[model samples]
Target: MADDKKKKDDEVKKEESEGKKDADETTAASSKKKDDEPKKPDVPPVIAAGLRLERILTVSSPSGGSAPKAAAAGSPHSSDSATHNAAALTANVEAVLHSNPGKIVRRWLGTSSGTSSRATLADLSKGAEALLSHDGPCATGRELVMLLAPPTEGGGEAMDVDAKAGGEEKKDDDEKPKFLSTAAREYEAWLISLAVRLLWRDGRHGDAHSLAGKGVSILSAHMDDAARVTARAGAAGSLGKAGGASGLYPLLSRMHRYQSLAAEGLAGEQGESARAAMRADTAAAHRMACLRRDVDTQATLLNLMLRDLLNANQVEQAQKLLSNSTFPDSASNNQLCRYLYNSGRIQALRLEYTSAFSNLSQCLRKAPTNTGLGFRIAVQRLLVVVQLLMGEIPERNVFFTEGMVAELSPYLKITQAVRRGDLPFFKTTVAQCASRLREDGTYTLISRLAHSVVKAGLRRLNVSYSRISLDDVAHRLGLSCATSAEFVVAKAVRDGVIDATIDHAGGYVRSHDLVDVYATTEPAEAFHRRIAYCLTTHNDAVRGMRYPPDAYKRQLEASRGLKGKKDDDKTDEEKAQEFEEEMDEDY
Candidate 1:
C-alpha cells in the first residue's frame, strides 16, 4: 500500500514538469514570429496625401462624385485588371493623336469619316485632289487619278456593294471629263492637261479626249489671258497639232485649225454623220498638205491615206508603203505574214483554192513557230480541202509522222468518226476539237466522210452502226464520251485496225476484208497474220520489181522466212509498224 502511494506521487510530479516545458516552447515560438515579421516604412504624410489625391482624382468625375457610379457606367461588369489596361490604352492613343496633328488628320482621312462607308469614284477623286493640294506638288495627283479610274475588267465599273447602292453613282447625265471645263476649276489645270497628253501617249484616247475637253471648257469660261493662251495651246496639242494659236497669224491659221478639227472628227466614230466627218477631214488633210511643212502633220496625213486604202481592200498600195518603210524587221515580218494569211482567207472565201493555198503556205513558212502551228494547221486543213476539191488525196500520213502521231491522232480520229457517219461520235469529236481548232466548218466534209465509212462498215456488217451511238458507248463505259474522237480512235485502232476508207466516189466505205478478219476467232491474231502476209508479199513484190535476178532470189528467200515464222512473241507495236510499212508499199 505504501509503495503504490509513492508511485502515484512521482507520476503527478512528472506531469507538472512536462506542462511547464510545453508552456516555455510556446512563448519562444511567439517571440520568433514577432522578430521575423517585415517592418513598415514611415512614409511622409504629404507624399501619402498626394497619392491619395491621385487615386481620388482617378476615381472621381468632373462633378466631383464617387468612383463607384463612374466605374459601373464605364463597365457594368465587375471591374478587373483588363478594364484598367483598356483605359490605359485609350489614354495612350488620345495622347498620341494630341501630339501629332498631321498624323491624326491623315488617319482621319483614311478612315470612314473622310472617305465615307461608301465612297464613289467622284468623291474619291475630289478628296484625292484636296489631299494633293494640301500636300503640295507631287506625283500624288497623277497616282490618285489612276486609282480613281475604273478597273479594266468587268466593263470598268465599280464593284463595291456600298458604292453601288448609293445615289452618288455615276449618272447618265454626267458628261465625260473634258479638259476645258476641268481647267477652269484650278490653277493645276495644266497638270490635268499634261495627264491627258500622257494618257494619249499610252493609247487611252477616249480618256484623254474627255479630260482635255473638260480642261478647255474650264479655261475658256475663266478666260484669264495667260490661262486662255495656255489652254488653247494644250487643246491644240491634245488634238495632235502644233500648239500656239494667238494673234493675226494664228487667225490666218484658222483654216488649218478647221482642218485639224476635221481630221479629229474623222477618227471619232463611224456612221452617216461619221462619213460626213471623214469627208470633211479628208478635205482638211489635203489642204494642210498644201500649207504646212509639219512633218508630224504630213505623216498623219499619210497614215489617214493608208487607212483609207486598207479599208477599200487596196492592200497592195498599203503593202508597198510598208515594204519601203524602215520598220523593225520583226514587226515587218509579223505584219507581212498577217496580211498574207488574211489575203489567203479572202481567197478561200472566194473559192480560189489554188491562190489561197499558195498565200497560206508562204504565210506558214514565215510565221514564228509559236504563232505558226495554228496557222500551219489552218493552212494544212485548207490545203486538205483544196486537195479534196481538186480530186487529189491529201497526204495526211505526212503529218502523222512518229513524232507527231500523238498530237495528230486527235484530228485523224475526228476525221475517222465523221467518215463513219456516226453523228453522235462526230458531235463529240467536234466538241473536243473546238478548243484546239477554231473553225468546225473547215473539218465538216472530213467528218462527214468518216461517218460515211463507219456507216458503210456497219452496212457491210448488217449491223446499223448508227444504232451504236456514242451515248450508248458512254453509258457502257460509265462516263461521258466528252473525250476527243482522236482519243476514241486511238483506243480503237491501237491494234492494227483501219476503221474505214474514202472510196473513189468520195463516199466512205468499210474495208470488208478488215471486218471479216475481226469477225474471226481472236481477231487480233488473225489481223496479225494478215499484216504479216501483206508485208511479206509487198516486200517480195518490190524486190522482184526493182532487183536483179540474183538479188530477187535472195529477197524472196528472206520474205519466205518472215512469213513462215508463226511465233506469237512479237508485240502489238512491232506488228502495227510492219502493217504500216506494207500499207505504204501498197499506196
Candidate 2:
C-alpha cells in the first residue's frame, strides 16, 4: 500500500511536468506566428484622400461634374476585354484605310479564280437587279457611290440618301482623290448606269437628266473610253471576256424606251400649235439626257432630237444629226441602221437623191430582219420609193426577198408601174393603194413618186425616140400643157437623170447619145481594188509560211547522198559555167 501511493504521487508530478511543457511549446508557436505576420505600410494623407474622393465621384457624381458621366458612357460594357480588343481592331482598320484601302476592299470581295470571273459579272448583274427592286438603293447605292467616288477631304461619313442632293455639291474636282482602281471602274460604270436607270424609271426625267448631265456625267465620259478600256483588257481584269460593257446595252434600251414614250405623244395629228408645243417638250427632255461629254448619250440625244426635227420638216436641225460626227461605229447594229435610215429620210426630204440612196441602201442592209419587221419593212418601203424616185427600176428580186413578199406586194405595184413607164397605171395604182399605204406610213412617200413616174416615162421616151416634141411628151405624160412639160424636162435634164436637152423654142427634147457604162474606168477601179486586196492577202499568206519541211528534208538527203559532189560541182568552173548557161537558157 505504501509503494502504490508513492507511484501515484510520481504520476501526478509527471502529468504536471507534461502540462508545463505543452504550455511552453504553445508560447513559442505564438511568437513565431507574430514574427511571420505582415504589417500595413504608412500612407500619404493627400493621396489617400484623393483616392477616396475619386471613388466617391465614380459611385455618385457631384453636381456640375461632367468627367464621371463621360467616363461612365465611354467605359466598355461588363466585358471590358472585348471592348479593348475592338478598339485595337478599329485602330488596325483605320491604319489599313490610310495605307491600302483598295487592297482591303478587294480582299473583302475575294479574288478571281478561273470560274470566279464569270461569276463576277453575274454577281454584279444580280446585285444591280436586286438593287433596282429594293428600297435600299438610296441607302446602299449612295454608300457605294461614295465608296467608288473620289475620296474627299474630311472623310465625310456616308449619310442617308435624303441628303444625296447635298452630296452632289460635294463632287468637286480639286477635292477628288484617286480612290478607285482600273478594276473598280467597272463597278463605277455599273453604279452610274443603275442610278440613271432608277432615276429614269422613277419618271424623274428632270432629275435623271440633271444627274446624267452633271459635268462628270457618267456616260459621256466613260462611253468614248470604251475602245481604250477594251484595248487594255489584259491589263484590266477579264472585262473583255464579259463583252466589254454589256451593261450599256440594257441601259441604252431603257433610254430608247424613255425617248419612245416621249415620241408617242407627238405621233397623233394634233393641231399645228399643239404639235409644235409637244415637239418642243420632247426636245427638252432629250436635251436633258445629253451630257456634255458623253458620245453615246450625245448621239442618242442627237438622234431623238433629229427625229422630231425631221418629222417637223426642220431641215436645219437635221443637218447636225446627219453630220458624220453624230453616230459612232461602236454603237449596236440597230442604232446605226436607224440613224442611217433617219438621216436618209432627211436627205431625201432635202432632195439629195444620191446621198439619200447611199444612206437608205446601207440602212436596209443593216436593219435587223427578224427582230423588227416593221422597221425593216419601213426601210424597204423607203428603199423602193427612193429607188423609183432616183429613176432606177428595181429588179424583180428586190421585191421578192425571203419572208418579205407580203410586205412588198403593195410596193410591187408601184415598182411595176415605175418599170412600165405608164403614168396612168402609176396614178391608178397609187389611188388604189392610197389608204393601205397611208396606214403603212408610206402614203406621203409614195405620193412624191408622181414626179418620178413622169421622169420614168421620159426615160423610156428617150430610149424609144430620137426626138420628141414637148407637146407630145406632155400628152403622153398626162400633164395639163406643154409649158409644164417643158419645165419638167428642164428640171430632169439639170438633175442628171436623163441625158437630154430641152429645146424650149423648138418645143422638143433631144436625147444625147448614151455611152456604154461597161466602157468606163468605174468598173476598173472596183476590179483594181479587189486585185489589190487579193494581192495583200496573198502576201500575208506567203509571209506567214515557214521553211518547207519536205523540201528541206529532200535537200538534206540529196546533199548526204551526193558524196560531196554538190560541193565539188559548185567549186568546179565547168559545172558553174554549165549551171549559169542552164539558168540563162531558162531565163
Candidate 3:
C-alpha cells in the first residue's frame, strides 16, 4: 500500500509542474503581444501640427506631465464644447474660402483682430488640416495661416520643406499652381512674405533671400497682368480698383525690405552679388512705389534704404536718397516718425545741425507716446548728441527718463562733460563710451563735439575774465598747444559765437561786453521756426483728415441746388414765408 501511495504522489507532482510551466508561457506570450503592438499617442496629430506651426518647433512638446491630454480626457463637457467650436470654425473657413475674391478680401481685412482670440484660434487650428487642399486659393490661404505661426525646435530647412503642401518637395517651379483670382494671388503674396520672415527668423538668410526674390517676381507678374487687363478694358476698367493692386504695394515694399535684409545677412558669404541684389530690389520697389503713388510704401522703403546706407557707412548715398525722394505728407505718423529719425541722423552726419535738430525734435514729438520704448530711446540718444554738437546742453530730465536710464547713461556722462566745458573729462568719457557710441552709430557725431566743448570753454572765459592768454586758454581747454587755442578763438570770434577779439601780437583773447537782449534776429528766427512748425502741423492735420470721396462736391451741389429755386413764383406774403423757411433751413 505504501509503495502505491509514493508512486501516485510523484505523478501528481509532475502534472502540477507541467501546468505551472504552461501558465508561465501564456503570461510571456501576452506581454510580448502587448509590446509588439504600437501605442496610440495621447496627443492628436491636429493638435501637434497646430503647436508646431504656432510656436518654436523645439518647444512644441507638452512640458507639464500631459496636462493638456488630461484636461481633454478629464471632462466630457470640455470635449463636447471643443468639438462644437471646431465644427463652427470649419464651417466659417469653408464659407470664407468659397466666397468671391472681393468678398474674401473684404472679410479678411475686416477681421484684423479676429486672430487674437484664443478660442477662435484653437477652433481654426483644429479644422486646419481638413480645410487645406492640394491646390487653389484655399491652399494658399492655409499656407499663409501656417506661416503666421512663429517658430520651434526644428530648423528652418525642415520647416521649409514641411511648409509645402502635404510636406512633399516641389518637383519643379513651372509646376506651381495658378491662382486665378486677384485675392488669391494677394494671399499667395502674403504667404510668401510670411515664409520669408519665418526663414529669416530661423537664420536661413540664403533661403529667405531666394524666396523673397521669387515673391517679387511673382508680384510683379501679377501687377503686370492687372495692368494689362486694365489696358485691354480701357477707360471703363480704370475705375475698377485695378483688382486691388493698392493692397499689393505694401506687400511689395515689405518683400523688398525682407530681400534686402536677407541679402545683407549673406553679404559676407555671397559678397557683391548679394549687395547688388539688394540694391536692385530696393530700386525696383522704389520706382514701383513712386509709380503707384503709394506714399506709405515709398516712405517705408525710403527708411529701409536709408538704414542700409547708414549701416554701410555710405552717408552720401543716404543723403542723396533723402534729397531725391520726397516723404509724402500723407504717410502714417509711424512712417513719418521713422523718416524724420533717419533724416536727422543723416543731416547730423552731414554737419547740418540746425536741420538735424529740427528733424530729431519733430521725430521725438511725433513718435507714438504709448509704445516703442526702444525707438524713443534711440531717437533721444541721437538727439542728445546732435544737441551737444550744436553747442547746446540737453535737458537734465532727458537722461533720467523712465525706462531709459541704463541705455542713456553713457550719453549722460558725455553730456555732463560738454555742459561743464571740461575737455579732458569729455575726451575721457568719449574714450570710455567709444564702443557703445559706435554701436549706436553716433561715434562720429560725438567726436565732433570736441570743438563744441572748446567753444563752450571760450564763452565761459569771456564771461569770467576781461582777457585770457592763448597759452592759458590751451591749458584750460586741454588743447595740445596754444596755437590751436588761438585758431579756435579766432574762429569763434569770426563766427560770432562769443563777444571777443583775438589779439595775435599780444597772444591773448579780449572779452567784450555782452550784447543787449533781443538786439539780434535770434529771437525772431526762433519765433518764426515755432510759428512755421505750428502752421505745418496744422496743415498736416488738415491733410490727414479722412473724408468720403466727392464729399465737398456733394455738399456744394446740394447747397447750389437749394439756392437755384426761382423767387418770382410767389406773392409778398408767400415770399416772406419762403424767406422764413430758408432762414429756418439755414439754421
Candidate 4:
C-alpha cells in the first residue's frame, strides 16, 4: 500500500512540473510579441503639414521640439511620406546642379548651350510679383526692390550686383535704364512712393524726403503725359510736407503752368492728360494749404521763423510773431523771452538805455533758470556801462565786490581770444539789466552786469583772473586810483570803456589812454574821437585832479606833436612817466 501511494505522488509532481513549464512558455511569448510591436506611425501628414506651416508663418520659432521630426517627414505633397518634400526638392535641385552644371546655365541664360544673357526689367518685375505672391514671410520681394534700386553717391553697392561692377557704376545709374518699360519704371516709382509715405507716417521726414524725391524724379522722367503730371503733383505735395518750403517751392513752380493748363482742361472736360494735370494741381494745392494750416504743428518751424527774424535784425517782426502765434504757453515763453531780450539789445544799440533795461528785465523775470543766464548777463552788462557813464562809484563798486566778476571772467577771456568784431559793451550791459529786472532777484541786476563784463572782457583780452584791481585800471585810464579797484575793472571790462589786464607784478595793467588804445587796436578815427569825447565828459567822475587850463592845453599839444613820431627817436616810456608826474603834481 505504501509503494502504491508514492507512485501516485510522483505522478502528480511530474504533472505539476509540466503545467508550470507550459505557463512559462506562454508568458515569454507574450512579452516577445509586445517588444516586437512597431511604434504608432508618426503624426499624420495633414497634422504634420499644419504644424510646419504654422512654424514658418508665425513670428516666433517652432516649439515642442517637433520641428526635426516634421522636417524628416517626406515632402508635404506626399500624404504618407514622413519627410518634407520641399527639402527633398531642394536637395534634388542641388544634386542636379552637381551632376549637370550646364543645365542651370542653360536654364538661366536662356539658350540650350547658354551664352544669351539679357536681364530685362520685365523679368525682374515678374520675379518681384511672384515673390510677393508667395505665402512665405521672407523678405524676398522687398529685398529685390531694394537691391534693384540705385545707390546714393557714398552708399555701398547693392547686394545683387558684383562688387567690382558696383564700384564702377555711376551715381546716376541708380535710375532705371531707359530700356526698362515705362510701366515697369512707374511700378518702381509707386513702390518708392509707398515706402516714403510709410516713412513720413512714422515721422522719418528726412528719409521720406529722400525717397519721395527719387520716386518723383523717376516718375517725371518716364511716366506718360497724364501720369507724369499726376506724379509731379503728388511728389510736389509730399516734398512740400516732408521737406518744407525749401524743397517744395521749386517743384511747385515747375508744375505751375501744368497745373493751370490742367485746371483749364478740366473745365473743358478734356482728355486724360488734362484730367491728370488737374488732379495733380488739386493735390499740390491741398498739400500747400495743409502745410500752411499746420504750421503750428511743428515747433521747429516757429522757432526757426523767430530765429530768422532775430538774425535779420527784425526785432519788431519777431515780437509780433511771438505775440500773435498760438504756441504752447510754456514753449512760447522761451522764444518770447528771447525776442524781448533781442529787442532790448536793439534799444541799447540805439542808446536808449532805459527802454533796453526794461525789456531785458522783463525777459529775465519770465525765463527759466537755464534760459535766464543769458538775459541776466545782458542786464548786468547794461548796468555796468550806465554806472560807468554816470560815474556812480557806489553802484559800480557794488557790482565788483559781489562776486559777479568771477562768474563773467572766463567768458570774457574766450570772447577776447576769438577776436570777434567789436560789440558795444554798454549796449550789452543795458540789455542784461533789462533781463535781470524782469526776472527780479537781489543779485540778478549785479550778476547779469558782472557776467556781461566778463564776456566783454574776455572778448577784449581773452584772459581771466580771480581778482582785478580797480585802482591800477583807473591809473592806466589816467584817472586817480579809486577806493574800489575791483569795481573799476569790472566797469571797464563790461562797458569796453577801458582795456585792463592783470600784471605779473600784482597790479592791474590798463591802457593809459582810452583813445590811444582804441586808435591802436581799431584804427578807426571815428572810434578814437568817441573815446576822447567820452573821457573828457567823464573827467571829473573819473577822479583825476584837474590841472590849470593852460597846463592841460600844453599837454594836449605835446601829445599831438608826439603822434606819428618815430618810436626809435623818442623815449615813449620816459615821456609817459613825465606826463604822470605832471598829473601828480597838479593833483
Give the number of the best model, judged by lDDT.
Answer: 3
Report lDDT per candidate: 0.42, 0.55, 0.67, 0.41
Q: For model 3, name the residue pairs that clash.
A: 55-151, 56-151, 56-152, 57-151, 57-152, 57-153, 58-152, 58-153
| Candidate 1, superposed: residue stretches over 4 Å from native | 1-331, 370-384, 397-587
How would you encode candidate 1's per-residue C-alpha lDDT over 1-587 as one tens digit per residue? Answer: 99999999999999999999999999999999998998786633322322332233333223333322232222212256355433322332222211222222223223322223233444434433432222222233435354545555663355665565564456553432211111112223323433454455555555554554444443333223322343443332211112111111111222233222333433534323544445455546445533432232333344444445444456576556545533222123544565565556555545566666666766766777754565566555655555443334446684574445555555676555434445566567777776555443354344434434433334433233422343443433333452433244334434334453323243222333335645667778657757965785587467556423355765676788853353356778687665544432321
Q: Order of candidates by lDDT, top first?
A: 3, 2, 1, 4
- Model 2 C-alpha lDDT per residue in residues 1-587, reported as the tens digit of each score: 99999999999999999999999999999999998998775533322322332333223322333433332321223246444333322222222211222222223223222222233222333333332212210223334333323333553544444567676677986443222111222343344444444555656554444344331334334433443444443213222222223323334433444534333333245334444554665455445433222234445655666776766668877786567444643444666787888888877767787778877877887677667877887887777777777767788897888768998998998888877667888888888888888776567677888877888888888888989999999888888899998888888888876889877789899999997979978699769857965785587468556454356766886978973665575756676565544432221
Please provide, for model 3 over 260-348, each residue's C-alpha lDDT reduced to its tens digit, 9 standing for 90 to 100: 77887885658457876577667777787777666656878888888888887999999988888788766667888988999999999
- Could you tell which candidate, 2 or 3, scores higher by TM-score? 3
User: Per-residue lDDT tens digits of candidate 4, residues 412-434?
Assistant: 43233223322344335435645
Extract clashing residue pairs from model 2. Answer: 220-294
TM-score of 1: 0.24
